[model samples]
Target: MIYADKTDLIYSLASTRARIFLARPRRFGKSLLVSTLQSLFSDGLKYFSGLQIEKLWSDRQYDVVRLDFSGLKIFENLEQFERDFKSVLLEAFSPLGFNINKSRENIVFFDQFKSWLLTLPPDSLVLLIDECDTPLTSHLDDDEAFDVIRNHLVKFYTVLKSAERCLRFFFMTGITKFSNTSIFSALNNLTDISLDTKYSQLLGLTEQEISLHFEDYLASAEKVLRLDRNQLQNALRENYDGFCFDRKAQNHIYCPWSVLNFLNNPEEGFLNYWYASGGQPKVLLNYLKKHKLANPFAFDEPRQIRLSELTAAREYKDIGIEALLAQAGYLTIRSVCSNGYAELGYPNKEVELSRAQLYTEELLRGKNLDPMGVPMLSELIETGSLEEIVARFNAGINLIDYQTFPITTEAASRACIQLFLMGAALMPEVEKHTVLGRSDLEVRAGKRHWVFEFKYAAKTKDAAQLLEAGREQMRSRRYGVGPGAGELHRAVLVFCGETRRFERWLEIEDAAD
Candidate 1:
């Protein structure tokens, strides 16, 4: 269903002479855009009813060469996958009267494609390739296999650069863009419009489009959600909005899948439809597990990166963690920072909670600890006493193998504690700075303000001394002295390295600056 009339931009794009490439997260309507283009080029204009492009584009039909690489089987080795893939490519041209196949020995695939294109008229073929990077990403785990497939990919993509004169309009879409990959090297003329301001709204749904398309649905959903029109829109923004892709950051987009699903089943009530549908994406999951989730706090804090980091072409092998998260839709531009930088954070509550759950699970499971205990902390806070909370928390930590997963420093230990707090929805801020000194963690509850100071002891007997030190650190530095100091409560957490859990949990009575 065409919710938004993006045909203007789509027409502007397809009417161009450049070979275009777009990178968007999986299920973000890339396939839909490809199908729309396929229709436009193949003279399927009847499907464009009431669309601006319906009257704009010429009715002349072209010989379209549309190749979908998403479903190719990742066979045992590069040799088998490439052989089958080559056969698929050649077979695609069979309908166009070119029956060339790999069975014709000694003729390479790209050469066969080049020879076939030479037989065609100039600017005669509209080539649209979808999921173009799947070949590279599918074999990322096997470095040797990845290199092999990447090498073959160079030959595969050369067909584009080779057939440039015979191509009418070219567009390819994928999830990730590789900088040092053979595609860019072989086909150097690709216009990467992924961050171009003009096409920023090309892939996702904008706010105005939602209202224009789903106003009636919104009116009915308002009653089901128990929210007024404004409240419902605000709620929707908090749950599914905040995706910004352009360098200028003029527009914020909503995940189309999440919004459509919410309208169909408003009773589900703004759940994390996109992330929850499949859990964490395969790329992110593999990255976190490969690193043993050493620095899970990376997901906890807002990250700042140069605009170049988001826009510049980088090899997949050398792409930054922040870039991966952004590319996979876990992170979105929060604000445009000075000095050509962008601050990135979880796009919405759904994404934030989903990340916390994923990272916490991987972090704890790596330590042989159970993840269920973390979320239980939120429930414990609502009902259980402080002592009771510690007891329950310790029960989970007892399963940790201290020898295998040692927490010898305050940082290592605090990171674990922060992960647990985040998983519990506490949203703990690490090293929250004040005029005097910094506190270990500052948590903002609605009415109550919390400052936590953590102290690590080498042995259990020294825990009490460190406990007092933590309290002194908080009091003298006035870690809890803020606008809500009246409702402020401080805690000193003393942990013993041997036990690998907080041995002392003290609640401070002092409210001082």
Candidate 2:
């Protein structure tokens, strides 16, 4: 098949011979990109009479060696994993006619391979390694096994650092960057292009790229979804639209597999392409069980954690939640603080909603349905009627078993308000470094915006007073700035308690003079 436009990454490879480290989330076409590069430089282009790389290298071809550790049982157990890996390498090079003249005994196979790579056609040799972090992550449960595998990988990669003259270019890819000097210390010269903006769309498909590639699919999609082209675009955007390689880039990209699958099966809303990459559910379940963390509905401020701290390889089964989540593609480091701290969170709406649904079901298993009080609140907010919301709140509180965890009346009220706000209100979606301050809920629908201040109280009068206070807080905080200046919308307060609480919901439109 003809390769799509990944001219940026290919251009990088062609422009320089430096060792490259490309870290992209899995199924972002890392393997395909590597394969394209291999075909370009290697002798596998016998059929490439008119491909992109053929246009550039019509006269140039070189010896290529590809190593895919992805299929290796690197996570199974350390000794067996290494032994199997030694065999895979021997088999990989044996077909390439490299001299395996030394005793076939199970010695340091990497050492033998290094000696052979040096004797190759100098700059004509390119080495590509894929899924290099598999070993480290797989053996994390077994420290001794992990250490042994880590040393082997380190020794192997470090050889590339010294064999500068023997290599034309070296490309390595993984879902996560290995911590400290475990394996990455081996290749000190490798430039990490994971966060480089130049090749942001190199592996993933941008909206423009998708539209251009599957123009035929769009017409079919529009017809099937009963949406016009623009509406179809908007629907696709809402579901799988938030991902961009550049933080500021507007070229929202969708997962290639998901898009294609949607094209193939137009009836599906959103398929689990993120999980389809494999092994995420197991990792998430493991982390959740270990941490005992809940509250997946609301967003939490990012936390700072060190790579060395994660690699300590002790306690909590030697796996850090942040590290595993980052690597498994569930969460991403949104920004790096000036103090060298990393802020991490869900990358997009697709991930956020799916994660919430999964975590909520897991944690709230066997919990009463009254815990989720948003449906009733939505009715009250949409119709400006408080009767239903009040009834639901009281019903939940009156029937509270409260045996699992000590629940304070105030805390329950706040949680009830949170559940309502989270589901009923449409929050201003923030991305990357844009800090969203704490507020009950910020809702925007069409031209109307609502800032809610919820106050749950035991008495109706106190609830009303608390509601007024919350409105004042909104005004004092300058909740919405700039564009909607003087366009202040409504501030609402909601109170729920044993004694009928008096709460007021005020409609504040853009105060036009």
Candidate 3:
């Protein structure tokens, strides 16, 4: 039944005397966490008998102002964004018989709301602002109006931060941390507990939690899919296990909505749960296209960020990579860096796949090709077969637009080969950015080092010959210019042309292969 996340909620709420700004992606159960806190603060101890909150304090009620703005979807242009945002204050406090009018904007509304909260007895003003970042995220591109909204938010939150004695506790949750000339600049006192291990399992569903809570659904899934529990677990894990808030606690979790989708539609697999929540990849994709940021990929933890740069409005392009992933629910802060560079990466396998898909979707510019290629390519990588991998690369060739510029068939073929190699480099590998012998991309996985080369054909020429020449070049390349020289595991050449693609995979299976 009731999970034990309430402990973290109580602690976070109680620990912060000033304003608190917590950011997590959609479907991470933020609303549920806040609601649980609301109940606890409302002195509903009967609802949480064994929760950690009960042990921390005696049952006491507080005058709470819970502004759950998640339900307000009215966001398109500037006027509506402002209008609806201000309207929420009225709706939230309307129960207090406050006849707030339309002329009162978000800033004024919030000021009045705070004043109302302060009027309550001392230590009675606990303000919870849910989906606080939605309004900002909704108008990411609209710089002019977004500035107003940001100012409104900043001034509103600054009150809570400034008036330490007037406010009991302030908590805000939202998807994606809005950086740059945003409200965070104003609420500088707001502590970001986004990575704290004490609240790591605060959002999302761990595998153990799912199996324990939804055993019936798992059984039903097994019966419908005709799969054993292990297979089902593997499938679920593959789709959703990579997100970890606590690096030591490997089973951090998946969004509860995604799990429910799998249980309800076992045949469809994990169908776009990450995209379903507010579905706004435009900002990320737009930036990617505008500036081709072909980063080999970044996965680590405690991603470093300059607080000043992050809250600047003009530096959207400079947003920290890890912060993006964290806001999008792809990464979590495994550790905090009081000083020095912050390391950030996917928490687990589930987040890895989700991030991969999200990145791929953005790269392809809204193309939704059947990811049958993903599993196929995954198989090729698993087998470590060069030929199979080449074929798969060719299979997905048409999916990529190779005609970025006009060139001879030979040049195109060469580009295609190299392009596929570039794509393959996105796989999990070490020294992931290095090009071996100035030829193929050299990557190390575990103890195995792989050298990959790609060659293509030109129109009006023999495609097969081009491939052979490409293979010869690869041999001449004689890579393994790294630490793992003698310990090389495989060398692969993938050649492509008009007819199809071929691969020449060689592993150190024997001394005379």
Which model scores highest in lDDT? 1
Query: CA lDDT, every prediction?
Result: 0.76, 0.58, 0.57
- Better candidate number, 2 or 3, judged by TM-score: 2
On TM-score, the candidate that comes out on top is 1
Clash number for every model? 0, 7, 23
Span of ten consecutive residues with least summed lDDT in model 3: 293-302
Query: What is the Cα-based lDDT of residue 323 in candidate 1?
Result: 85
Q: Candidate 1 or 3, higher TM-score?
A: 1
Measured over all alpha carbons after superposition, the RMSD of each candidate to the real structure, in angstroms, is 4.4, 7.4, 8.0
List, residue by residue over 1-513, the lDDT tens digit for candidate 2: 324576545855755878888876666778887887787777645755554655555436777779988776434556677778777777666766665565764655666677777776668777788877665655444567767776777777766666668788789887665454345556666777665567666776677877777887788877777879888787666656554444323333566655666777777755555654552544356456656454432334465555333223233354566766655556655655556455567666556555544543443453443446455444454454345545654544344333432233543444444443433332333211213455555555445454555566665657667766766665655565446533345455465454433245554343331
Better of 1 and 2 by lDDT: 1
Report the alpha-carbon TM-score of model 2 versus the true structure. 0.68
lDDT of 3 by residue, 1-513 (tens): 436344745665675565676666667778887787677676657676766766666646776779976554455666776677667766665765555545766645666666655665666567788987665655565668668777767766665655556566778887656556456776666777665557666777877778877888889888888899999898887666656555233336676767777777877655566655643354454445555553322322235544332223345556655456555665554444556334455655445545555544543445543254355444455454555565565555545544432223433434443333334333433323435446435544445456554444433255446456655655554445455444464444433333444433343333122
Compared with the true structure, model 1 gives a TM-score of: 0.83
Task: Assess the local accuracy of residue 397 in candidate 2 as a C-alpha lDDT between 0 and 100.
Answer: 39
The residue ranges of model 3 lying beyond 4 angstroms of the native Cα positions read: 1-12, 15-18, 49-56, 71-77, 97-118, 162-164, 179-182, 247-251, 264-272, 276-317, 331-513
